[model samples]
Target chain A: MLEYQDYILTEFNIVLLSSIAILIFLIVLLIFEASKIRSKFGMEEEDIEHRLDLLRHLVGAGKAYLFIADKEGAVVDINPDIQSLMGLEPNQLYGKDLGIFTEDTPGSNVESLWQVLRDKKLPFHLQLRGAWKNGEEFMETAEIRPLLAENSIVGFVVSRIGSTDGEGQSAEGSEELEKAYAKEQVIVESIGDGVIVTDAVADIVMMNKAAREILDTQESEIGKSIYEILQLEDENSAMLLPQYHPLAEALEDERRVMSRSYYIVRNDFTRISLAVTASPVIVDDGIVGGVIVFRDITKEKDIDRAKTEFVSLASHQLRTPLTTISWYTELLSGAGSDNLTDEQRNYLDVIYDGNQRMIGLVNALLNVSRLELGTFIIEPEPTKVQDLIMSVLRDVQPSVEEKQHEIAFNSEEEMPEINLDPRLMRMIIQNLLTNAIKYTPDKGKITIDLSRHYPDLILKVSDNGFGIPINQQDRIFTKLFRADNVLSKNTEGTGLGLYIVKSVLDRAGGNIWFESEEGKGTTFYVTIPLEGMKAKSGTKTLS
Target chain B: MMPKILVVEDMEAIRQAITAALAKAGYNVLQAKDGAEGLEIAFLEHPELILVDIIMPEVDGIEMVKRLRDDDWGKTASVMMLTNVEDSDKIVAVQKYHVYDYLVKSNWELDDVVEHIKNKLKAATEENS
Candidate 1:
């Protein structure tokens, strides 16, 4: 029985060994075949590279620019056209990060996108904001495709298809290049947002499907001036002046222009609101053309208008009850208090206090709502900041005295009255002062300093109060967000003061920042341009 | 003679509160429940100052003011807009008709309103002199 089992085991081993040998032989054959196929592909890649070199040489004599980057996004080579466009010497950009030539656009992570495409070995088209070495801004559509060899990515060919040096190129060379890029027109057609590409003279060169659909144009709009086809108008349906036209501004200034307040009158005699972004396609340090991207925002405008109306109605309803409560509370506190007991009087006082808090919240809500609605008007006039601050201080003198806080006011001796919205300034000053008075403990020191710093007037407010908690400081400017330290110490804060101040400053092209140390103190710095606030015509003013 | 002021607020509580406060401040105060009654009283009595609410039943404050401006006696009459609607269009509209002051009612207390009226009337009196 043992010999029989041994024979069976030996037979099984021989069978398994033969199977393994055969499998190894097959694997070696497959590897050999793969290498052979790889070599064939390598030869074809060399042929394609030669052809590309020939093509690049041919295109070098034209107006177009060509840029090449390695797999890791380092610039490998750039044609002479690109050299002149970027104002760089020959071979100067080699080994440098290709991102240096690109501007950082909001909401796009170019680094991660490149990493993703490199890993996937995929081709992608991107709307690139290209920057010249001389700090000139331009826009272009860039096609980045992986240079593949033996089924692996080796490098990238970054090609942009647009006439850069407009009139200098041979017509034959440009026509050949245009024909080569005809296939890419499918990509532009597939984009959802409306796109209109124009030439240096603001004449339309290409209009995408979405653009035609949005503009309600059935006939081809090609060769027509973009201004004539777009017919962008203001809110009052008045035709936008040449200076106000975003595309014109982009081409003339060679900078990006964005506007959400533009309306386009369609062939159907209907007007639609548009959120438009126009960027100049600059090349060779010259304004070549512009690319205008627009989207219909009629629905968004409608929704915003409805929300504003709702808030307006709600505020009116809210204020009516608030007014009743406050006025009645006043009457009771003034005359009816003579017949009330001490505890009853205290309850009345509490009611009045609560009502006042509600009123404050309502006022803050109205201001925030107006700001969000874009209905907050800024009407600038020459105003003395010192006098405004003094008046606000006078109003809050009782509160300051009640808190026993020492106040100091300092200013430059020859401070000139600057153009500013007095009412808005008063609101900002009142909020800052009230916050300082309310947050600081008895006998805390508060200081106010006003000084000029060339293009800006700086106003500094410092308070030796319970400073913001370190962890909660980042959220202080967020709407209705109070710091943890302040929340525990004081319940009077509506948490809207800093937010309102920030929003107002942002709209007026001013800035506000703060330095705070937990358990130490807080200082807020505000800067407004000396050139003054631009007057914005809107339906309401911030209360 | 006490300077008369008309209170044309739709809210009874607000009207009575302002009227009582104004009376206490040594002014003869006439009360109206709505803009219609206020206009009738305003035309009949010709108060020195008319405190009108913007949003009211039947005839609104703006319409009332517009009609008031059509009359010679009411054209230059002092009208203080006392309402919760802080609309710029409404304010501009009232300004064209010469609204003496535009006050959002919730922002003022009974005492402050009385004080404001006293100051406004004093100024008008001085202007006349």
Candidate 2:
């Protein structure tokens, strides 16, 4: 019996030893698994840190803030740069919601976008007016990129790039803007014509390289008042007042202003004729700044002067011969040569007529040269429009009687004396009336109506004559252009009368237009400002 | 006696034509081819009226008028400017010398010029009376 008990005790000891060994093996397996899981979590943390470092490197020295949040947008970690850019403590941002730093923009909700990112694990961008703990705000462009772990979103990396005071852009957006700005700089610097940009008060904001060279200015002239720096003179070499500056006019009127008479004096005391145009920059219906484009036109002016001198000389040479013909023809037609036969008299009459036509042609050509050269002077005097018209009527009465046309003169009562160049006014009236009488059939109705329309003196010359053809009406005002109907009807017109009239009116800031039909008569409408011709000081008056 | 008139012109045809016309109109006429010769005859003869041409050799019409006005009688002398070229400088300059009329030669007929001179002489006589 004692031997049987010993065997049982030995079996029990072997079984107990095997069971303890199995428990020990299980504990060792659990320890190894736990250690592997801890190592995997450590790798994910290291990956997030590496990504944060990469984001920091990407932002460079830009005013940027980077932070990492959990998948639910709960702030997990932030860079220290947030303090300098956003005036925020990095520690305070930790454990807070990302919504604390960002506000929803119009048309887009940060919470909805964050929800979308969390659900779809996709990256998104938003513009934010970032709010600080003390209620201060900054505009920022924010990008939220999802952090992933093993094919599932783990967290988000939020980077905000913005200005501390004004509007801000994303890192990529800022880079693009810099590139565009550099391109603009290159274009402005490379232009050959002088360009100057001025602020609202006429202070120089930027000047291109060509502008600097033309003005003999240096880089340090920026920010100075443009009027003070740019010394200008008129065509007469008189000092150009600041009030007359094209830039001043452009800014005040908010319209483009152009003038070819401006002469800019450089710092070296040399003068250059400039054709300048100034335009106002308008933003949101308000004038913000101005831009001036100018170029040197001294050589052109010299060539133009030479052309005018040649025309003057040629006209003088031509007039001497014409005057001799006129005097001798008059002498031969007089009673002192009464012995001439009828046929001889008729031949003399024809010579006289041809000579008169030649004189008229020469005069017309001379007037055209003066008009085209822009050398005609405008001398304004206060004169009654009615009296001037009456005098013109008397002068043209002989023609009126010859044509047997009815002249209907209708004028506004109490017409005041308007400031106008009398010679130019006479030219305007004579051309219109004679054209009316010449083109109209004998005894056709010619009407002259003069009235005041406040800012303008309106004149309408209507003729029941051969009307201008519809197809050729548009070219009527062109120099040396005669309507086909007029060309067919009369051979006496120089085709320059209307051109001269239009040029005179244009120089005086007036307008001209006509209404005509194929069979019906034509009415010409002219509007001259009541204040009269713009007084211009020039060298020669229109002949 | 017929009114004495002086014709000064550089162009021979124009000067003779004007002289012949003036003589036919019953005015005693004096002729000079240029302003220098015209001034010599004017200061010596003291004609009643002087018709001066603007562009001439040696002395221009304006310079002749300037020197003529230096004499006591020349200040009020009847003078008319005959010019084919419409020069503003000469026109403006002649205003200071009391020129009676500025006639663009091509624009006026011989009869009109004669009539203008007759009317001008009559007006001067009336003013003198």
Candidate 3:
């Protein structure tokens, strides 16, 4: 009996000890799991802090002004960029209503900007008047965009500011801009020229007051194409392609183009000679639009016609007298016999020389008239510069020898044959050489140099002569404008030589420039583009 | 015998100078105060050539030419235009009337006008022959 009782007690003790060990193991496992969960939560908190820091830096560095607003549209936080743009510090603007900047804005502009933000649109422009802390008001063009997160509106607004003078001002603040616009309007209205602007698509976008007045159209014609607006006859109108239109051509060629003369009749049944020039408005690397400026040149044309008539009549009338002088001089010389003394012969020679001089002057006058009337047709053929220069040299040789002046001609080896009008070229060179001889002091040196500048042939005439005064340079090429100095020294000059030279050069797409000091000397450079003579054929048709 | 020619001009210096030159050139010259007198004399005497100035009182050179073209005396005699106005429109008008030649006063010498007259007379004689 005593042995049985002891075994039962021991078994109970073993069972109690095993149950306690199991409870201890389960508690240790629970502690390990709880520790792992706490560590994971800590890591998640750290990740969120890092992400927020990155976002804050990004907002601060960005150029577009950034601000955070509560759901009620109260400003929560403002970035430095926004603070500077609004001319306010961060603390001063924090928690202020976002509507503060919009207070002076037009109601429609404010409403539209707000609506765009609320609708979560990408961005929109806002015209607003904003005041600085110093009580100064400014016009501002701003772009407002909403900050979206997780496909829902976040607590932020992003605004970018542009010029404060263009579109942002209230009616009062816009007075300056309005005044400028009015001044431009007045200038455009008062001008006699017609001005038209077209978009890249060649549709009329803007027309100045003169253009509208000239076209004799009402406001209803604003959105029409140029062709429609002008009501041009198909046959008379220039053939314009999408790329060949003056504006478009300017864009493609990167140069301005002048159209041929066209006729425009006014409402009063007055005819006008119209000339058009189209130039492109190039921005950055592309063409945005083009402007066409036109003017009426009828008065100029009439004057030109009158001048042409005078020249034609003058030439014919002068020729008859010249012929008489020539015949009488020949008769007098032929009538010479034993009775003719040396004094008589000398007197006749003086008369003959004076007659020749008059003839030369008349010829120069006729040449000038032809050039001004655009009737001086240059028929270009293969010609040698050397030969042309030599002929000019021969013609002016007598004057050169009479003045005891020396002329030197220098030409490049292998000088390319140039295409030019021999008659015109002769006239040009002869006039220049004659002027040099006439103006130079006795024993002065004159040099004619011909060289090929790539794409052009250059003729330079340098003379140690009575140089043109610097103050009188501008009038040198004006018809009948002899330099004061030249006029004082010489009374026989018609003052038409340089004028004709300039006109001929202009028509041939050539250029002339001279450098002179009153006493030193003068060098005149003439550049004749090789391709320009070819282009002159088109000018001939204008006559 | 020198052929009779009428000189009509507005400028006194030019008219006197022209008369002197023609007389020296051995022509029997008649002088008129203006285009009207010139026209009257032209009809009465039927001079070989009537020298007319363009701008004048009562009748201008162009009007005189137009009247001569319309008259019987005009067909038998020749008319020449002498003027200082050398405009294209004037020339066109002169051409329309088949005036012998248009002369600019500033550009012409006294001898030129005398020679032109002589040429016209010679041509008329040839046509008659």
Of the candidates shown, which would achieve the greatest TM-score relative to the real structure? 2
lDDT ranking, high to low:
1, 2, 3
lDDT (10s digit) by residue, model 2, range A398-511 = 989998999999999988888999999988988888888888889889999999898999999999888888888888888889887777778887888999899889989888
Among all candidates shown, the one with the greatest lDDT:
1
For model 2, state the Cα shift of residue B29 in Å. Answer: 0.7
TM-score of chain A of 1: 0.61
RMSD to the true structure for each prediction, in A, is: 18.0, 17.4, 19.3
Tens digits of lDDT, candidate 1, A1-543? 656544533432344334334434544564456546557666455545543553443234232225667767788767554566467886677898777656545766677668768777776666656555656555666666776666677666666544333322333467777777886798888889999999888899999999999999876588898878988998767899876799988888888999898998888888899999999998899887889999999999999888867866687799989988988878887875789888988998899889889888888888888887777899999999999989998999998888888999999998998999999989999988898888888899999999999899999999999888888878889998987777777888788899999999998989998898876788989899999987888988888
Which residue segments of model 2 deviate by more than 4 Å?
A1-176, A238-243, A283-288, A369-377, A469-475, A508-511, A531-534
State TM-scores per candidate.
0.68, 0.73, 0.53
Task: Compose the digit string of candidate 3's lDDT tens values, residues A1-543.
Answer: 545434433432343334334434544554555456457666465444433443443344342344556545678666543355356877887778777765434445566667666774455666545654445554445555555555565554544443332233233355777789889877866777888877655568778877877766666355677655543221233434444555567767867988645556656666566677888877896777777788766787788789786876777567555645654664565434356788988887888778867776776777666665655566778888789999889877887889899889999989877887776777778778888888878999999999988889899999988899988999888988887776778776778888888888887778888999887788888888865464343222111
Q: If you assessed candidate 3 against the hidden native complex, which CAPRI class would it receive?
A: incorrect
- Single out the weakest 10-residue window by summed lDDT for candidate 2 chain A: A162-171
Higher-scoring candidate on TM-score, 1 or 2: 2
Error of 3 at A415 (Å): 2.4
iRMSD (1 decimal) for each model: 0.8, 1.5, 8.6
Error of 2 at A146 (Å): 31
CA deviation > 4 Å runs, candidate 3: A1-193, A197-203, A224-271, A275-293, A535-543, B1-129
